[model samples]
Target chain A: MATFDSENAAHLHRELHSHLPSDPALRVKTLESLAIERGLVAPQTVDAWVEAYSEHIGPKRGAQVVARAWLDADFHARLLEDAAEAIKDLGFQGSATGHLKAVANTDRQHNMVVCTLCSCYPFSILGMSPSWYKSAEYRARAVREPRQVLSEFGVALADDVAVRVWDSTAELRYLVVPQRPAGTQGWSEEALAAIVTRNSMIGTQRDLPLEAS
Target chain B: MDAIHDLGGMQGFGPIPIATGDKDFAALADWEKRMWGLARSGVAQGVTIDWFRHGLERMVPSDYLSFAYFNKWCANYLMLMLDHGSITLEDVKRGHLLAKEAEAAPKSIDDVLASNAQANISFEGACDTPPAFAAGDAVRTLRIPPPGAHTRLPRYARGVEGRILAHHGAHAVPERGAEGKKDYQALYTVAFSAADLWGPEADPRDDVTLDLWEAYLVPA
Candidate 1:
């Protein structure tokens, strides 16, 4: 029986598919790096592979629906009601999270999301994850010290606004649809897209004012 | 519209610590550094592919995201002034520049990766998978614990019986707990009536379904 052919090995091979290398050298570096990541290989090859893979993937796009939602109230509602389908219409599948649900953040309340079991997230729409967001520290502390966690992200809730934390259940990967900012009143789609940061939509960061055109 | 982390500021909780040393700044930075170090180290050692890259680590989080995150701190006062037309971008710019410099470092690519969960999976759970269990059938949740799992299945669900409310289809295993390996995994929703999962005290109307792995169940 081949040790690298177990169920886990298959999974490893699947994760391996996500890798991209610009050249032959980077390809070797990436495989070597992953072996060390799983504690399979030695330490000397980690950085080169990381550098290669890191260069392959781009910033998480977040949900394009956040921008769509900002413009379309009905779609926004649908995103809140059924995040997966609403997003699928936009061609965003929860690749990271096989299934998904959306949570919204409002002025009266702020929402923070975490995967208690492990960093369950909706990557189809949100994009590649933040390292800290998936870290054990973020997961363990987010629930126990939520206020502190929000504070770290600089989300200061008022006395009236509530702060809610969602501990990811086993089946669902969740993301945040932040409230549309007031200032983008007449901004065009492209303009609105400029101000929509990935973290803001994820509810980890807040919205910034659009520069006056 | 609530985030999974929106549970703070509830009435039952005590007064939260404010500005507590950058609000666990040391810990957060340390956590990222560790992940960064380990990930980089893993590559340095022998492991090579990371399914994704985090954003901040990839590109500088534009001035916009910087304000989005940092504004939640002590800057609220200044922001309110600017919002009410009390201050100009010029006024804030000077202070902002200093703050940016102070806060800035070699931008990381951590946030460039998936903000949501991205598990590596092979088998595609066809949308139209045939059902093994029906809504009315009484079923039990399988309790096979895979190695390296920090699962949420209560101990009671291990050998207990519940009805199969729905067949959720084949789902890719959650890659994180499985150390980033996910494959064609069968998923089912085991509906434990409030009373069934807990006891008679559980409310009859407030039933919940446990999204379970096929490995976690057998017929009751």
Candidate 2:
């Protein structure tokens, strides 16, 4: 039996379907057109959702939450206690965030989140999941070999710092509250948020940049 | 269903293609954006997330492995619309030429926005019974039979003992939700040490946590 190689599977699919309208773009167009024509969905509805995610919603919401958590001690405590409710304190709540949990990175421990079964991310807060996050390689390895995966993402952790990998198996989503960077004291909330990268909240990156961009 | 989608703890995949700078943050392609919008619209039209995931899980393993993320989503959306009797095979085959005049009133963009905004899939609800296990209770996951259908229990965690880290109140069960049934059960965050799951090869200091329903567990 020949060994299966997932990396080449896409190429193999294209080779097999060389003569067909094998493009996914065509399929999406057909589906959208049919859906709209059948009154199943509005064309503007499609565009609205696209605009909502791409333009309005993204990592900035999560960054604001992280920045607030760093500055407000009460909010930080509430965020750790109940992230879903705490986020609403800042008016950040939506789908995929109802059962949220905020796990903070500390001196002794680090946290990361992955959805091994499909890409279950906190899209309402963190926006659409990153391509690397949704990749098969991440879903396959993040749970068993998290240290190695983090290393691949350029996040090296001390051996003593325990890694807590959250596998989003159910409805609940996670937001990893990375530790505030050093020398970032007395910074404004907006200034603090500017330094918090999307990957940092996802736990693929640690050590936020000190200088606000 | 013991499908390729349950990729946790699997091996032999290459390094993650971590794109540099803002390239990883590039805007979605036009088709990808349309696919995502269509998915949200479907959800607003009553397709549960669990049902959508189940449909994806039912895809042929080879195709599931080969297709891109949005490509798989596009395929699943078509299957769902077909199953829902909203579209026909002939319509899909003929592409844009099959488009018919819509008979229903078109929803405004604001309506769409509001509908989607309120379409939160939070399963959190009150449970009739108290939670069987509390935080710090030792428990073992049930080893469900093969050919499982739309279960949140991953293969790697089955038959393994772990301690409950937190009880997350009652939430709608995905397994039942996939079947168009609404059932609530107490959910807990279960913590398993890396040493227990992967043996000596794993770092002793590390651990993994999974949100599991009460039914999947019993006293260890």
On DockQ, the candidate that comes out on top is 2
For each candidate, the DockQ is 0.06, 0.38
Estimate, for each residue in B1-220, the C-alpha lDDT of model 2 and write its tens digit. 6777898998899988686212322376788888888777663245666777877777657777778788888777666665665655566677643547654455555665566455445788878999999999999998983222678899999999999999988988887777666889999999999988888999999999999999899999
- Docking quality category of candidate 2 according to DockQ thresholds: acceptable
Interface RMSD of 1: 19.7
Q: What is each predicted model's overall lDDT from 0 to 1?
A: 0.45, 0.80
- Report the lDDT of model 2 for residue B11: 88
Which candidate number would show the highest TM-score if scored against the true structure? 2
Off by over 4 Å in 2: A1-20, B20-26, B43-45, B96-117, B145-148
Model 2's DockQ score: 0.38
lDDT of 1 by residue, B113-193 (tens): 332123333334543445566677777764545543333443434566877755656765543323335454566656554
lDDT of 2 by residue, A1-213 (tens): 111222222333333233225698887888788777877777777777787777666899999999999999999999999898898776668778878889999989999999999999988788878878888888989999999999988888876799999999998899999999889889999999999988899999988878653
Question: In model 1, where do residues sit more than 4 Å from their true spots?
Answer: A1-30, A33-60, A169-171, A211-213, B1-150, B154-220
